[model samples]
Target: MVSSRERIKAFDKKLLKSGEYSVILSRLPAYIFELLLIVIATSGDKLSEMDVFIVMYAWGLTFYIAPYLNIWENRKNVSIYEVLKSLPVNQWDIFKVRVEYIAKLLLSRFLIMLGLQIPGFMMTGKILKENMINSLAAIGWAALVLTIYALPGISNYRSNKQIKWKAKQGGIMWKKM
Candidate 1:
């Protein structure tokens, strides 16, 4: 059996070659804004409660907006799911790979945010408890938002037999006359 890591690497390569990474550019503003918020929250001698709240809100907003931005960006193109389906891999593996890809993407961002805190500590000579808590909360909220966004796709892949059945039937629908 092929390893999940190998599958993910293959998918990543394909996505990269197809210029799918460009879609991330659409989210550049959110990323920059989040980073700015982090800098603001961490650079001070004392943590501001208001700054922490703004950082939390910014994280939540960024996470919440990501799914919609992805959908909109890919609306005119073949989706990652469809690309995975076209591959020779099993349906279950396809689902796993997609979820793993998303997880890795989110994880990298989380790590970057955490790493950004280090500079703030160096500059300020102290780590703020509130900032740490804010980081944890942001990641928790991101995971929740991503999971909620992923549910519909997860449901579609949960039953391969159902999908096959619908595909075979051409998924016909009746419209009101």
Candidate 2:
């Protein structure tokens, strides 16, 4: 039987292999489009706090669709969950590893988007303090909304050993890996 730690590592790798990289790469076009929108939106003028907020918000919202897209792209394929479910590991172990995979992906997206937004922020002609605060605030709100959206799944983990694969409301939609 594989150790839980090893199983967790395998699950993470499965997730990375399945479609995360491709999903992230596919987002490049969307990012470029949003950048163009921001440039056009603020053409010939310095950006207001609202403009900064809109850009940061769009940036945050763009990457937010990545994980879901990854999941959807691999929906017909056999998931790591399907593979691990018959193994010796406990169900919670599988569920926790899945959550970890999601959290890691979200964190990476947040960092990547934030880093990519710095240039846009600088272009706004705003003071560094204002840009930093607004960027942080916008990212923070996006993070909060993402967390709230995940809360139902997290709470479901408390009552159920295995993550739900059903599409019904209140059911966890994330497939393994």
In order, candidate lDDTs are 0.53, 0.49
Tens-digit lDDT track for model 1 on 55-114? 554455444334322332312322344445556656555445545655676676667666
CA shift at 162, candidate 1, in angstroms? Answer: 24
Per-residue alpha-carbon lDDT of model 2 for 1-177, expressed as tens digits? 768867667755666567766666756754664565355333322224465655555445534443432243322323333445567767566555544545565466445545544665567654545544554554455555445433434333422333343434445475443
Clash totals for all candidate models? 0, 0
Clashing pairs for model 2 are none
Alpha-carbon RMSD, each predicted model:
7.9, 7.9
Those runs of model 2 whose alpha carbons end farther than 4 Å from true positions after fitting are: 1-6, 20-48, 51-70, 73-125, 152-177
The most accurate candidate by TM-score is 1
The TM-scores of all predictions, comma-separated, are 0.54, 0.43
